[model samples]
Target: MDEKKIAVIGAGIMGISALRRLSENKRFLLTCFERNYDLGGLWVYTDQTENDVYGRKINSAMYSNLQTNLPKQLMQLEGFPMDEKCPSFPTHTDVLAYIRKVADQCDIRKYIKFNTEVQLVTPVSENTQDTKWLVTYGDNRKKNDSQVEVFDAVIVCNGNCSIPNYPMIDNEKEFGGLVIHSIRYRRPELFAGLNVAVLGASHSGMDICHDVSKHAKKVYLCHRGSKLPTFLPANVTEKTSGFKRFTSSSIILDDNDIIQIDAVIYCTGFKYDFSFLPEGILEVGQNGVVCNLYKYILPRQYSTIFFMGLMRLYILFFPYGDHEASYIKAMLEGSVDIPAYKERIEVIDDDSKRPWLYNSHWEWDKELAGIAGNFEPFQSALKKIRDHVLEVKAKDFSKFRLDAFKITGSDSFEIL
Candidate 1:
């Protein structure tokens, strides 16, 4: 059998987990590309604040004090559970170590080309069966002189959070306070004895506001949400209205209220960063969602290319990656046949009008899970996910992530 040449991009959790499934048999000749010196993707913590240098952008969004918001049990790769020593919510360092541990266990280090940044991925022809892609990358030694390789398929796991989404704070350059996104946020000591406004109430917004409130004299959590959590610290006051504009030292609320603040920290979240992909093939923008995807895995225009771990899920991420990887593997093996390419295009076209990006993850993931569930390991993980997400959502995010669990068997665990 001619081994299928598969290229896995980015050595993050999704990239590595996908590698585990893709390299299941000798039938695959897999190659993994990572720009970093090592793996762990976003989990690898770097102190640098500037996300972009020259042309490339830093992919990792991990903060120094950040811990896994979800329990370790929920975050485990289906077959490979997190180490017993790891706590429920492991730290940034702990998550990186766990990824390395998975890599060592899977013996995938040999397949990866470290410090190699992928420059471009484009299709070769109009024929569907002739699924050849040109993957160009630059090695550390000679970065200017790049090289290209042909692969049967491409799995994009570079992550969506590499590009931080900071909407314009409409004003005539009046605001002069320090503006920092959550990605560059490390510690809160910089806001000591000062007034800080944390924008957006997303996960990062909530977490960053919590961190800043400890040091800032008064932390104003300015968000558009109707209600804010009451459990927030005394120093952190939630504002339901959004920003109208800002002055040199004061922030004007949408309701025409003004508050003096020393800094404006935007926990504004991120957008999908897929610059390596061909510009015309995919339409990913500042909207924070990837469009024209069939089942949210394969792009409708390019079925051979798959993007993993882009969906916003309430459940753990590792299992989602595992399921996606398994499905991609199955598709390559022809064991699972999705709808015809034409039919897929129609379905995506119709759904494109709706809020497909945010609302379609559950159904798409479920469908993929059902298809991949026919295989070993993934079957168990998928079975529990539907119930698990519902159960987890029923509880409070702060307290729920703290609950401990013990893995009793493969793809199975009991909440402790």
Candidate 2:
């Protein structure tokens, strides 16, 4: 058996899982490229938001006080539990430490190239079964110092939250207030004593709004969603209408209410950035959804190319990556047959939503685990914990994280 050379991009959670799974068989020669000095990806929080000393855009979206929205039990990778002494909803530092521990236990650091960035990845031959990939990368600081390497396969585990998606407002240019994306947001002190308008009602949007409310004079939690959490801070007011436009010192809501605000924080999520890959290799939709993927992991035309952790999940990301890594391992090791290109295209075309896996992770995890051969079934307790967390959050938006939980059985959990 010939050793297959594989390039895994980004030593984040997804990349670590891929490296761990693929390195199991000695036949795979894995080389992982990470731009940072260490693993942990987005969990690696830095006070510097815009650019590092090397003039690179900071990749972490972690805020100073951010804790795991999902509990540690649900966030654990298979057979790798977080520290028992740590709280269920551990802080970002705790999560990063856990990620480091996983990598150390798996001995995945040997395959990783720290301080290296993958500049581009292109298929050597478009239509061949044995098509190779050209991975061009170099020192993250030295733009001109690039080198190319050929590999039998490529895995893209670079995260999605790095590049922020800022929605255009009608008169945003005329606004005098400061405007920034949630990706650049780091602390609540920045909004102290000022009336702020937080745009978006998604997880980050709601969380940021709540965070800012602590220091801000007033926070308008603006969103398009009809259902707003009733348990908002006294200073945070729910605004269900969309943003009509922005004035110099105020914002016009869809309801024609003009409210004075000192700043606008867009928690409008992020764009899926695969700018390094050539156009035809993968197709991202205009609305920011990945369209060229078959199962949110495999590209329709390139069986050797896998994109891990592309879907938005309500479940913990570790298990999601674990399931994906298992499937990719099976495909790379010749344990499972890769689907025909035509079949893959048909499956993608029939589904309107290609990679939005929110609320459907259980079935998806089971399907991937089953395909990966002998693996334990997706645990029922995880789903229970997730649902319990959601219920707790819905009932008490600001105080849910204060509660801790312990899994008691395969389908039960006890709150502490």
Candidate 3:
């Protein structure tokens, strides 16, 4: 078989993993494009929330003083454990360092084109088996100097967190206070001495509420979810009723009560931005849900194009990337049999909103690893430990970060 020229869209966690695994196969000629000068993607922190040094709007949502939501054990890629001295939930800097170490050790940086942003990706031909992609990319600083290159396959690892999902709130513009998304949020000191309302109670919402509560005069955690941390900060108030409208100096709840607040920080999460890809190929719908993916990895229309790191697999993203990269390698090498177009499309559950495999994520990873023929199944202890961590977090969100656990066996762990 001829060398299969492939173009990877990013140099983030999943991009690095894909480069490492795919490059291992002698039949592949790989080139990875990274817009930023360095790797680490969103894990790379910046104080400038709006724009980068190149004048491009910053897409990374990493903030100062942020720590991993999951323990380090669940964050490691295959065959590479995080630093032993690192805390259970290491800081953002520590995670970035670990990602760099993995890329360096794997020698994947040689294929990277840094400071180059991908502008567009389009199919050169409709023939799935021999399909080629026209990838247009150029220096991040230059606008009209895009260069096009043809590749046998295109792997999208640009990630979903780059685009902030701002939901519509009635009369939101009328709100006199400052409004910002979690992506723009950095230091808690920004909210010092002010009453802030945090919308959404997910991991980011909860963490931001906790951080701001220490400096802000008060924080109102507004969410519709029922399961929330029981032990919230003293200054933090939980509001189950959703936001109805925004007033000039306050917000009106669904029950018609008004709460005075100085500012609002939206923790409503992110959306998928595939502007580079042609329309009709991939459609992003309500709540940022994308459909027509066979397993959230491959698009129903093309076999040569693959989407990596798109699943909402919580803390298992690193392992999931490894499995996906390996599986892609097998599929390209003709070692794994792919289902027909109709069969693939028929198996996908369009009703499922989110791209993630919630409860079946581990099983899905196992299935991918098995198909890859070179990877091992996930450790049984991982799922158990993850479940335990989730349980602890629900009871006391603050305690989960401080608590550590050591894996004792395939299905057990000892608290440290």
Give per-residue CA lDDT, model 3, range 1-416, as digits (tens): 78999999999998998998898887899999999989999998989988777798898898897998888888888889998899998999999999999999988899999999899998897646447999999998876778999999989999889889887899999988999999999999999999999999987998999999989999999988674646999999899878899989999988787899999999999988788997877766555666667676787778899888866677577877888888888888888876678876776654354345456787777777776687887888988888888888889888888788898998888889
Model 2 agreement with the true structure over 1-416: per-residue lDDT tens digits: 68999999998899989988888899999999999988889989999988898888897899998977888887888889889898878999998999899999999999999889888888899767558999999998776879999999999999998888888889999999889999889999999999999999878987888888889999999888786655888888888888999999999999998899999999988887888997876677756667678777787777888899876676778877887888888888888888888988887786545344555768777777777784665678878778878887888778778778888888888888
Give the better candidate number (1 or 2) by TM-score: 2
Candidate 1 on 327-368: residue-level lDDT in tens?
888888778876677887897777567665433555656666
Q: Model 2 lDDT vs. the true structure? A: 0.85
Looking at model 3, residue 369 earns an lDDT score of: 74
Q: What is the lDDT of residue 49 in candidate 3?
A: 87
Residue runs of model 1 more than 4 Å from their true location after superposition: 51-57, 126-129, 140-143, 285-287, 350-364, 373-402, 406-416
Model 3's alpha-carbon lDDT is: 0.86
| lDDT of model 1 at position 81 | 72
TM-score of 3: 0.95
